[model samples]
Target: MFVWHGRLYVVRQVLNSWSERVPWWRSTVQPDPPVGAVPERGDHRVWRVEASPGRALGTATYDLACVPPPPLAGHLRPTWTLIRVAD
Candidate 1:
């Protein structure tokens, strides 16, 4: 399950998934994280899935991403990102 815009969506089928490594050197936003840092400020796993809000009949294609997040208060809070949506 994933939440977007405060709506919870359940993945019905995973259409595709892959890993991506961002060339941090080519980034214009900000510098990459320190050495050994996870996610590298760009690397992430993406999944294209068929999903819907709360088991609704209407479904949409959703591009989701997962990354190894940085530590927070000495703990890790792994989160997901809803990259795209197409009904």
Candidate 2:
């Protein structure tokens, strides 16, 4: 979920979610993805939104497992912010 302008929106679920292999040559990680920590390709979610004025619509991935309370609230509801995730 995220906020735009002054309105709020929620991502009920990812629709056309997909992922690409992390380019090992381009990657800076000391260790590459162990086996298959992430998916190679597939469409993710097509967020369901309640439209906002100045808000810029886009997609972001999140790992709810690490973030704590307050920050997590944004995901559970709508806000004018983006949830950053590393894949």
Candidate 3:
């Protein structure tokens, strides 16, 4: 789930999702990996999704990347960052 312009949106479909080799702490953004992609020592996972703004209105595509929790923070659930949006 995510909020945009005061509207909460929910993912309706996963258009694509993959894991990559880059560390989540790095500021660099790599190009998306192929579908069903796998990486050695992968550290980042991104998901491209179609979401609706909570009311069955038009949908938008959202690219979200998982921000892994700190080491030993197993009690903490991972969070996601909103990377892109398109109608």
RMSD each, Å: 4.6, 11.6, 9.0
Give one digit per residue, the lDDT tens place, for model 3 in 4-58. Answer: 7787998889899987665564534655557643322246688999999876598
Indicate which candidate wins on lDDT: 1
lDDT of 1 at 9: 82
Q: Write the per-residue lDDT of candidate 2 for residues 1-87, one digit (tens) a residue.
A: 455445554554453332234355545545555762442222222222232233476544432211122433444432122324432
Off by over 4 Å in 3: 21-42
Model 3 scores worst on lDDT over the 10 consecutive residues at 33-42
Model 1, 11-81: lDDT tens digits are 88999999887665667666665776554446789899999887546888999878777655257655577
Q: What TM-score fits each model?
A: 0.69, 0.22, 0.65
Alpha carbon lDDT of each predicted model? 0.77, 0.36, 0.74
Candidate 3: global Cα-lDDT? 0.74
Candidate ordering by TM-score (highest first): 1, 3, 2
Question: Backbone clashes in each candidate structure, one number apiece?
Answer: 0, 15, 0
Which numbered prediction scores highest in TM-score against the true structure? Answer: 1
